[model samples]
Target: MRILIVSWEYPPVVVGGLGRHVHHLATELAAQGHDIVMLTRRPTGTDAVSHPTTDTRVDGVRIIATAEDPPEFEFGRDMMAWTLAMGHSFVRTGLRVLAGERNTPEQQPWVPDVVHAHDWLVAHPAIALAEFFDVPLVSTIHATEAGRHSGWVSGPTNRQVHSVEWWLATESDSLITCSASMRDEVTRLFGPDLPDVSVIHNGIDIRTWPFAPRPVRSGPPELLFAGRLEYEKGVQDLLAALPRIRRTHPGTTLTVAGTGTQQEWLVEQTRRHRVTKAVRFLGAVDHQGLVGLMHRCAAIVLPSRYEPFGIVALEAAATGAPLVVSTAGGLGEAVTDTTTGLTFDPGDVAGIATAVRAALGDSAAAATRAARARDRLTEEFSWSEVAERTAGVYLAAKRRVRHPVGRPSIPERPLPERDPGQSD
Candidate 1:
């Protein structure tokens, strides 16, 4: 299969989980003997005029980055402009590739069998290219604007984003989401007329995150919270729980990783709670650093108020870090309370503190759960499985495009329920 992927983010320029997901999915598809072409935004400072399109190969996948610098403006007006520019650039570069102007002797020009897009940022280009080439469009809605804002669409920028999301859903032949909760959210927004939405959970490559063996902690144990330090991320809830956590487990330290708009506010809150000395804000840590932190920490906490699917939970579990996550959105589905790890109600500071204390106090049981979670990750959430399932969606979309009449409807199959004994 020849697949063309249009996304706003890719490696070395990743702002969030979408880039990492696209990188691994494309690479894995290429490894499975399929041709993959990725069109994403160029990194900052790259001369757009001189290098309108930059091509590179990573792990057998060809990446074509088009120059589309974000505009400076308040609200999401800049994003609106960026999306338009990105779409225009994608269409321009895609035309060149289709004409063999950008291909080498070994790799001849070929029309993509399917055009897969990630999120609304690249929806315009994906829809345009699919129509131009008469190919099936497969869209993956990683998250939605309404979901991010708790179903409150505010301002022109947000309304525009929401409109684009709706357009993408209606235009695409098939849709993919990271969780069942997200699948329902998309259905509610787009209605029953929308294309079949498949639930494929985000996966992690366990081998890439090499686990470090840490000896039993004789001193104060460490609790790590990684992700954007935003209100939606529920980092503030974690901060609020620190005082209660320390009362039971004195001298326990907390390490907050990742940077976001709420960093300053979170710092202030720590001072107000008088737990400033016990918390360390590492801002953003590199991949290896994060894996190391996961290994060293006694438990990894994810207190998200609205997580579509907590990829961090999978990463922490893969590294054998005991998990404590909020029962918010798809997080509860990700971690089986008391089995894989523990879960608490979102924003319940006392519940979070209790889960953290239980996890830290019973090191043996926590370690057992962590080990089970890692095994489950390999069995259920491996990239190979995800790629296979995604490829299935592509094939289904193509079949539907080829035979529109008397075509069987794409089934609403949620990902297999989380199982401890599932095999890879």
Candidate 2:
């Protein structure tokens, strides 16, 4: 199958989980014998005069970066301008590929069997290309603007992005969400006219992450939080719980890894709570540094008020790290409370404190749970399985497009069994 993926971010230009998701999915699909071409924004420092659009390959997948430099202006206006520029570039690239001008005599024209778009940022281009080629369009809604702002569209920017999200959900032949919670949210926002939605969980390559044997800690217990330092992320709530956490587990320290708009406010909260000395804010750490921190920390906490799918939780679990996650959105679906990891209600300071103390105090039990969580990663959330499920979605979309009437529903694929002796 020939597949074309349109996303706003890719390798070396990622802002969050979406970039990594696309990268791994595309590469895995290509490895499975599919022709994959990824279209994403061009990173900084690329010579536009020499290469207006750059084409590169990684692990058998082709990546094309065509977006122009972003404008320096207001946030909302800049986003609108960037979307238009990206759409224009997609059109140019789509035309060239459809024309078969870039193909050799023996090779066929680079026409895609399916066009998949990630999030609303690339919705315009995805829709346009799908319409032009008369092919099936599949969209993956990683998260929603409405959900991010707690069902409130505060301003023009919020309202505009929400509108785009609705458009993309309604227009796509098939919609894919990272979690069942996200699928429900999409349906609630878009009404009954929305297409068939599929839930495909985000996955990680566990073997790539370095996991050293966690040594028994004799000093103050270290708790790690890694994600965007924002209000919705519930980092402030974690700060609120620190006082109580310290009361039970004296001298406990918190290390936050990641940067966002709420960094300054989080710093202030620490001072207000008088736990300033106990908190260490490490702005942002690379993958290697994060893995190192994960292996060292007593437990990893994800106190998100709204998480579409907790990919970070998967990363933590893969490292055999004890977890304390909030029962918000898809997080509850990801971590099985008590069995794999413990759960707390979002923004519940008492609950966060209790869970953290439990994880820190019970070394034997925590290690057992962490090992189970790692086993779950291999059993259910491997990239190879996710890519295969995604391919099923594409096939279902194509079938639906070809035969509108009496189209059968795509059944959920069962989880594949993992060999006990196999690694990753």
Each prediction's RMSD over C-alphas, in Å, is: 7.3, 8.5
Candidate number achieving the greatest TM-score relative to the actual structure: 2
Off by over 4 Å in 2: 44-47, 67-77, 97-100, 103-108, 399-424
Which regions of candidate 1 fall more than 4 Å away from where they truly are?
49-52, 69-77, 100-109, 398-424
lDDT per residue, candidate 1, 4-123, as tens digits? 999888996798889999999999999999999988877644546755667888899889888754344322336687568668878887888664484456876668999999999888
lDDT of 2 by residue, 1-424 (tens): 9999998888878988899999999999999999999888675434356447777888898888884644433333477765666677777866675544655687766778899999998988898888877789999999987787666664556677778888877779999999999999988877577789999999999987755556879799999999987677998889999999999889999999999877888898899899999999999899889999999999999999889998999999888789899999889998999999999998799999999989988988999888888889888999999999999989989523432333212212322342222111
lDDT of 2: 0.83
Q: Please, what is the TM-score per model? A: 0.90, 0.91
Count of steric clashes across candidates, in order: 0, 0
lDDT of each: 0.84, 0.83
